[model samples]
Target: MNKSLSRLESALLLVAPLLMLLGGVLLVRYDDQGWDGVLAAMAAHPARSDVGWLLVAAGAALTVPPTAALAALVRARRPGLGATALVLTALGWASVPAYAMGGIVMEAMAHAPDRAAQVAVLEQFNDGRGNAFFLAAALGAVGYIVLAVGLARDRVAPAAAAVLIGLGGAGTLLVMAGPIRALLLVAVVLLLAGQAWTVTAGRRTAPASAVAAV
Candidate 1:
C-alpha cells in the first residue's frame, strides 16, 4: 500500500478508538442494566442512544485496517506469535457486526410499543450468539496485549511501551466504572509514543520493520 495511505489509516486507528469509547459511554448512561431502564432511556433519549451505537460501530470498523497492518509488522518478526495475535485480534474484532446489530436491536426495543415487546427483543438477543459477544470482547483485550508483547519480544517496539499497552488494554477491559475508563487516554498517549519510538528505531536500522505502523 502507499506510505501516505498507511499513515492515514494509522491515524484513523488512533482516533477511531475514541469514537468507540465515547459511544460506549453513551450506551452506559441509557441502559441502566435492565429492560425497564432501557425502555425508559429509549423513551427519554432515543436519539442519544442511536448516535452512541452508530459511533461505536463506525469506530470499530474504521480501526480494522490499521490493526491488520500492525499485526503484519509483528508477523514479519515472529511468525508464530504474529499468527496468534492476528487470529485473536481478528476473532475479537469479529464482534463488530454483532455490536452493530445490537444497536439496531436497541432501536427496535426503544420503538417497541410496550414492555412485553421490549422483553421479546431483549430475550431474542440473549440467545447463543449473545454468549459469543463476551468471549470476543475479552479476546480483543487479550489480542492487543499479545500484540504488544510480541512486538516487544521481536525487538520491533519499546518494551516499556509494550508493557503500558498491555496494562492499558487489560485495565480498560477489567474496569467497570465509567470514570475509570479514562485510563484509555493515558494508554493512548503511551501507545502513540511507543509506536513513534518503534518507527524511529525501524527507520534508523531496519526500515522494513516499521512498515509505517502508527
Candidate 2:
C-alpha cells in the first residue's frame, strides 16, 4: 500500500506540472486580448469563457498535489527543515485557487450590461488590495524561499533548482512592477522540474524499510 501510494504521488507530481504548464501556455496564447479584452471576449462567448476558466482552475488545482508531495519528500529526508518547507509551501499554494478562480469571477463580470461596472470590477480585482491577495502573496513568497533553502540544505534537490525557486519567489515583486511578467512561468517550471527530480531521486535512494514504512 505504501509503495502504491508513493507511485501515485510520483505520477501526480509529474502530471501536475505538465497541466500547469499547459494552462500557462493557454493563458499566454489566448491572452492577446489582455485581461480587459479577454473578459470582454469571454462575455461575448460564454462557452469559450467557460472552457478557459475551467482549464485555468484545473491547472491551479493540479499544482497542490505536487507541492504537497514535495513537502512530504523533504520531510522524509530532514524533519525540521521539511516541516518548515511544508508550512511555507502550503501557505503559498493556498492562494493559487483564489488566483485561478478569479477567472470565473471575471467571466461573470463580463456579462454585466454596464461596461463601466465591468471595468470597475476588473480594476478592483487587479489592484490586489484585498486581505486574501496579501496573504497569498506574502505566504507564497516566504514559503518558496524557505522551501528552497530546505531543499538545498537537505540535498534533496539540485542546488540550481533551489536557486531557481528562490529567484522565482523574489521575481514576483518584479512581476508586480509590470516588467518581465514571464518570470513567474519560468520560476514555476524551474520549481516543478526540481521537485520532479527530487521525487525520482527519492524513489531510487529510499531504503526498502523506509519505503515499506511509508
My TM-score estimates for the predictions, one after another, are 0.73, 0.71
- After superposition, candidate 2 runs with Cα above 4 Å error: 1-5, 28-35, 44-49, 76-80, 125-131, 165-181, 202-214
lDDT of 1 by residue, 1-214 (tens): 2232256755765666677667666652323246666566656776776787677667667656776666676777677777777777666666755665665566666665778777666666555656567577678778878888876775555687567655554443323112343554454355445544444444221344465563
The 10-residue segment with the lowest total lDDT in model 2: 172-181
Kindly provide the TM-score of model 2 when superposed on the true structure, using C-alpha atoms. 0.71
Pairs of colliding residues, candidate 1: none
- What clash count does candidate 2 reach? 0
Task: Report lDDT (Cα) of residue 201, candidate 2.
Answer: 55
